[model samples]
Target: MSRYREFKMPDVGEGLTEAEILKWYVQPGDTVTDGQVVCEVETAKAAVELPIPYDGVVHELRFEEGTTVDVGTSIITVDVAPGSEPEEPAAPVAAAAPVDAPAEEKKPEGRQPVLVGYGVAESSTKRRPRKGTSVPEQPQAAPAGTYSAPPTAAAVQGELNGHAGTVTLDRPLAKPPVRKLAKDLGVDLTTVTPTGPDGIITREDVHAAVAPAPAAVLPEPAAEAPAPVAAGERETRIPVKGVRKAIAAAMVGSAFTAPHVTEFITLDVTRTMKLVEELKADKELAGLRVNPLLLVAKALLVAIKRNPEVNAAWDEANQEIVLKHYVNLGIAAATPRGLIVPNIKDAHDKTLPELAAALGELVSTAREGRTTPAAMQGGTVTITNVGVFGVDTGTPILNPGESAILAVGAIKLQPWVHKGKVKPRQVTTLALSFDHRLVDGELGSKVLADVAAILENPKRLITWA
Candidate 1:
C-alpha cells in the first residue's frame, strides 16, 4: 500500500543476465521524470544507460558503483507520491482456522509469491513457533510431540479474513524467482535452512546449499607472525567479469573448437594509399572519416563478393554450414572495457561512402563505449586492424559464429620491387585466418588473393563492383 515503486534492471541486450553499474546520475531525494536517464551500466558487450519509466523522487540506490546486479532485480526505489503519508500493508497472521468450521471452506486461492515469507502449502498450514516462550510443563499427551504449540497456532485461515497471510513450517517458504533458482541449481528447498525475516528461505540460502560444506578442525595454536605487507604491494587480483569475462570464454571456446588455417600475404598498397588521399579531397565524402581501414573494409567486401563462399559459418550442432549472401561486416575495436566487434548490418548492400560512414560511426561508438549488443552480433566476417597498434600482422583467431577474420598490419614505407625496379613503396602484410571446416586452403587463398589484388591496383574497386 506504500507509494514506493521499484525499478528493476532490465535485460538490455540479447539474454544478457547481468550488468555492472558504472555510474549513477541521480542521488536520493532527487526528482526524476519519466524516461529520464538514471544510471549507466556495462554488460558483456557494451555500456548502456538506463532510464526510469515513471516520475518519482529517488528514495534509495540499491547498489553502489562497480556492483554487478542480475537482470530483473530491483536496483532503485522511488516514492511516487512523496508528500503523502505512506500506507503500510495489512500484517499477516500465522494461525490455524477454527476447528468447528470445515477446513475445505478455508482454502485460499494460491498465487506465485514474490516475497520470501510464504510457504508451498496445501491443505493444512503449520506455522513455526516463535522462540523464548513455552506453553507448559504439565502432564500432556506425548508432551505435544517435542514442544508445546503457541496460543496463536489456533488462529483463523487466510480466507477467514481477506487481508491476512498465513505461514507454515511444514513447507519451504520462497518467492517464485527464488524457487526457480533453487530448481535450476538442483537444491531441495526443504533441506535449506531459512535465514529470511520470519523464518523464510532466501535466494542466498538456496545458493549456499549447493556450496561444499566446510570441514571442521580444532582451533590452531598461536604461531609466529609473518612480516606485515602494504596493501596492493604484493599483488592485486581483479575479478574477471563483464566484457573481459565474455571475451575470455569466447576466445577459449573458438580457439579450441575451430580448426584454423591462416594464409599470409604481403602486398604493395601504394596505389590504395594514394586513393585514400584522393578520397580525403573529394567533395562528395565531406566530413567523413577517410582512412586505410575504410578502404580495407571496402576491399574485403569486394573480395567477399568475388568469393562469396568464404563468408560462411560452421554449424557443428546441425552438422551443416551456413552461407551468408549478405555480409554483417565486423570491425574488431579495442576499448577500455575490452575488445568488441560491432558489425555493420548488411555491409554488402552499402555503397562505398555509406560503408565508410558506417565504419567511422562504428569505430567512434566503440571508442566511446556506447555500442549495443545487437551491433556486436550476427557478423559473417571480421577485420581486425592490428595495424593501429603498430604491429606488422597477427594470426588472428576467428570470432565465434563467424568462419573467417582478416588481420591488417601496419603499412610502412618499405623498399620493394615495383615495375621491376627497387623503389620505396607503401607496403603492408595481410593475414586471412579462416575455419578449415568451412573454408579449405584453396577458398581461403582466393579470398586473400582478391583482397591483395584490389589493394595493389585500386582500380579493381570499380571494376570488381
Candidate 2:
C-alpha cells in the first residue's frame, strides 16, 4: 500500500563519482510536478539543477544540504499517490533480504532511478548482526510527514555507538588516494575528524591525524594588548573540491605525462590592433564584441590552416600521432568555480564574425558558470590570454588530450624599429607550448611563426584563409 518512490542522484557530469548537494529546492510535504527542479548540486565540473521526472509529493530528503552523496544514492523519496493516506515506507525494508533468506532479486544499484515511478530494486543479501548487539525492532510508522532512517544508517549508528568491535561491511568514507595517503602516514581513518562534507574524510584530515600540532597556549593579555587571535582568525582552509579539484588533478597529470616544449616570439601587432579598431567601426560587426582577442583567435585559425600538421594529439596506448583535420579551439576562462577551457567546435569553418559570436557566447557562459561538460571536451588546440591581466607571457601547459596551447601577453607601447626608424609601436609577446612528442621543434616553430606573421600583417588572414 506504500506509494513511496525513491529518487537516486544521477551522474550529472561526465563520470563524476559524487556531487555535493548545494541546496534543496523542495522539502518534505512539498508537491513537485514532472520536470520540475527539485534540487541544485555542485559537481567537479559545474553546478547543475536536477529535475524530478514525474509528479509527486516529497516524502523525505535522505541527505542534508552540503552533503556529498555518491552517484546512484537515493537523495529523496517521494510519494506519487498523495491523494490517499500513505502507508509505511516498506520500500526501504523490502529493498533487501536477510543473508539467511533465499535469493529473490538482485541488488538494485542497476535500477538507476532517474525518473519518478521507478521501483527500488531489492538487495541480494544483508549482513548478519553482531553477536551480543541486539538488533532494534522496527518502530511503527508514524503518520505521513515523519521520517525514518534507512538500514545502512541504522547499522552505521550501531558501529559508532557502543559497538566499536562490531564487523560491518561499510568502508570508511575517504577517496582512494586519501586512503593511500592515510596508509602511508600510519593514520587510521576511524580516529580522524572528517572536515569534508557529508562525513567524508579529506587529505587535510588525514595529515592532521598523523601529525597534529600542539595547541599554542597564549598567556593572559595585558590591558593594552590586542586580544589573542583564535586559530580560525589566523588562517582559513578551503576544501579543494569541485572545479578547482578537477583542475589541479588535470594539471598534474598533463605536466607529468607529456613532454612540453615552449617557443616564444615577440611581434609588433600594431597592424592587428588597427584592424580591431577598423572592425569595430564596420557595420557588419555592429553588435558583436570586437577586441584584440577576437583578432588573435582569427590569426591562430589562419596559422592552423597553413600548418595543418600542428593540430594533433599523442596517443600513448596506440603509439601514434592522431592528426585532426578539424579544429576545436579552446579558450581558457577563469570562473569563480575554477579555470575551465570550453572550446569553439569546428572553429575552422566559422567566419570571423561567427567566431566572434562563438567566442562572445563562450566567455559569457563561462562567466555565468553555465558551461556544460560537453563544451569542454574534444579540444584539439587551446589559447590562454594571460594578457588581459597585464602579464608578459607564460610557458602555458597543453590541455590534456590536446597537442598545443598558445599564450598571449599584454600589448604595450614600446620603442621599436619600423621602416628603419626607432619609434614607439604596439608590441606584445607570444609563447607556444606544444607536445614535443607530437610536434617537433621545427613544426612548433612554423606554427608559432605563422601566427606571428598573420598578426603582424593582418592581410595574411585574407591570403592564408
Candidate 3:
C-alpha cells in the first residue's frame, strides 16, 4: 500500500481567501519532482504558479480547472510510495447519481470536486428509495470506442442532446466559473452552442453569445425579414474575481478611509523638455529611458528631500506620525489585468542612470504580468502619469497606507510670460493629493511648488539636490 499526501492550497497573496485554478500541468499517474510547478492559480491580486513541495506520483486532482477553491483546501493528492500498483479509483457516491443507475457506478465526484461553499456528502453505492414509486434500473453505457457492448438508449439520447450522456446527462457541461459568467451575462447555457472538448461550455462561448451579430442586408422585394427578432444580448457581465476585484476594493478603501486634500499647480517645463532631448543625445544616457516622466520623477524626489515631513505615513493604531527616512518610489502602471503599483525599492539611493534602468524594467515587468506581490508592498509615495493619454490633469487618490500621490498632466506648448514677453513654452499641470491628517495645506503646497520650480528651471535639480 502507498501512503498518500493531500496538498492544500496556500495563501499566495496577502490574506487572500480564494483562488481560481487556471491550469494544471500534471495529471494522475504522472511522476512529479519536488519544486516542480504543478498548477497555476489566479488570486485576487495576480496569477501565481504553485510548485509541489516534494516528489511523488500524482494520485488525483481534487478540483477541475476553472474551479475556485478556498485557501487550505486540498487541491491535489500525491502517492510517495510509487513502486506499488496504482490505487483503484474511488467509487462514485449515490448523491451525484440518480436512483436505478446501473451496477457500474457513475464517475467519481473526486474528479469534479465539490464547490467551495458545499460540503462533501456521504458516499453510498446504493441508491435511496423513493415513496410510492420504484424506477427501473438502467444499465450503464459502455465506455466510448469500446466495441464489447453496443451504446445504450440513454447514451443515444445523450448524443442527441449534444453530450456524451455519461455524467452530464441533460444538464449543460460547464465549470462553476463558466456558469457564473453565463449567469452574469444573462445568457442561457442550454441555448449556447458548446465548442469546448466533450461539449463543455467555455467563457468564449458566453462572450460570443453576448455579442450582437451583424444585421443582414435584404433586397428591396424581400419583405424586410421582420428585423431578425434581435437574438443577441445587449450587455455582457464579467465577474469581479481576480486582479480587478482587488483594485476595486483598494480604491474604495483608500477613498473612504482617508480624507484626501488635493492641490494643483501649472508650470513651464520648457527647460525640462530641453533637458530630456539633451539626455537622449548624451553617450552615457544612451540605451536608457530618458523622458519627461523621468525628469518629473527626479523633480518629485528632490522636492521630498527639501520637505521630508511630507513623506510620512499616519500611524492610526499607534496614534503617532511615522516619518520614513528612505523613499520607495511607486510608479502607477496600467496592465491588461488591472492597475498595479510596483515600486522601485530604495529609489532615493539610486543615481539618474540607475533610476532610468529601474523604471524601464518596472514597466516591462508590469506589462508582461510578471509583477510579484512583494514588488507592490511597502510604498511611501506614488506618481501616476495620466498625460500619456493626452489628459490635462487629474486629482488622483492616495494609494492605501501611503501619504501622497502625484498626477502628471499632458505637457503642451502654451503661451507663457518669460522675461516680460509672452512666448510659446512647454507647460503641464501637476496635482498632489495627500492625507490631510499628516500633510496640511502649507506642506502640500510647498512640495508641489518645489517640483514645479525644478521643471521651470532644469538647473535647479543640481542646486536643490
Candidate 4:
C-alpha cells in the first residue's frame, strides 16, 4: 500500500503569495527526508532554500526549475511508503505521455516543472540543450560540502562525478552563456581548466583563458572564419521565467499602483561629513565603513520624530490611512542578482554607532541575497542613495507597503553662497516622494523640509525640534 502526499510550497514570508523555483536539489524518484533541502526559491528580496516537509520518496516533480508558482502550490509529490519508487526514470528521458496533467499544465521546453507566478497562465517556451545531449560522465555533482567547481573542463568533470546521478561526460559543464562564449572564441571547453569551487567552470576563468590565445598564436589568415563571424554569429535569447520574471512583475506592480511625488533639496553637509571623518579615525569604529549615508539616515530619523506621517502608509482596502509610529527604515541596494530593499527593524531606537553598524550589516546581507524574510518585512519608510553611483539626484519610487521614499544624491564639491561669499562646499541633493492620497502638500513639504534642514545644519540633530 502506498500513502502519497503532495509537498506544497509554503508561504516563506508573511503573506507571501508566490515564489519562483531557481533550481532543484532532488529529482523525482529520489529518497528524501522530512527536512532535507529540496529546492531553491526566489522571493521578493532573496533566494531561499526550501526544506521538504515530509519524509518520503520523490514520487513526481510537479514543477520545473525556473518556473514561478503561487504560494501553497504543490511543487513535488512524495510517497510515504518505504518501498515507494520515485515517479519514473531519473535520466533526462524523452517527453512522456500526458498523465492526467492539469488543464493549465504546460510543457514549455518539454520540461516537467511548473512555472510559479500570478497571471502567467502559459508555460514558458522550451530550452534547447547545448551542443551535447549526453550528460557529463559521472553526472552527480561535486560531493556534498565540496566547493563549487573551478572554471575549467577537468574541474567540471570532477564536479559531475560528485553529482547524485551519472553524467555522460561528453558535454561541457558551463552554462548556456558560457558555452556561447566558448564557441565564439573557438576554445574547446574540454581543454580549458576550471577555477570555480568544487571544480565548476566560471565565466572569469573562461575569459582569462581566452585572452592569452591570440597572443599565444599568430592570427589566422583572412580566408579563415573572420574574428567577427568566429564570435557567435547568432544571438542567444534566454527566456525570462523565474527570478527575472518575478522581479518584472513586482517592479510593474510597485511602479503603476502607487501615485508618486518627488521633492529635492541641496545641503552643504559639511558638519555631518566631518563627523564621519572623525568616526573613521576612532579606534572602535575601525574596520567598519563610514559613509555620508549614515548621517543622512540619522537626519531622516530625526526628522521623522518631528513628522511621523512621512513614515506612514495608506490602506485602501478599508478606506483608511494607517500611521505607523515605529520606523522600519528600508535601504535600497543594487546587487548582482537584482535591486532589493531590506530594512533595519526599529531603526529609530538604535544609537548613532549602532545605526552605522546596522546599515553596514543590512547592505552586506541584502547584496549577498542572504537577508531572511523576517528582516525584510515591516518597513514604514525607505532611502535610496543614487549618489553612490556618482549622480546628483533623482526621484525614487516608493516601496510597495510604505508611503514615502527619499533619494540621496552624490555629495560632491559645489560652489555655494554662504553667509556672504561663494565658496566651494560639499553639497548633495535629497529627493523625497510620498503617497499623494495619504500625504497632502503641507505634510509632504514639511517632512521634506525638515530632513533638508537637518542636513543643512547638522547641529539641529543634536536637539529635538
lDDT of each: 0.75, 0.75, 0.74, 0.65
TM-scores of the candidates in the order shown = 0.67, 0.70, 0.67, 0.64
Which candidate would rank higher by lDDT, 1 or 3? Answer: 1
Please identify model 4 stretches exceeding 4 Å from their true place.
82-251, 283-287
What is the descending lDDT order? 2, 1, 3, 4
Please give, for residues 195-243, the per-residue lDDT of candidate 2 as tens digits.
8743567778987877732111112111234456787796646677777
What is the model-wide C-alpha lDDT for candidate 4? 0.65
Regions more than 4 Å wrong, model 1? 1-3, 28-33, 55-57, 81-234
How far residue 406's Cα lies from its native spot in candidate 1, in Å, is 0.5
The model with the greatest TM-score is 2
For residues 278-376, could you state the per-residue lDDT of candidate 4 as single tens digits?
889988777775788888898889888898877777777987888898998999877655566778889999887788899999887665556665565
Question: Cα miss at 8, model 3 (Å)?
Answer: 0.9
Q: List the residue pairs that clash in candidate 3.
A: none
Clashes of each: 3, 0, 0, 51
Candidate 3 residue lDDT tens string, 204-256? 89889996321111111111233333567566456676777888999899999
What global local distance difference test value does model 2 have? 0.75
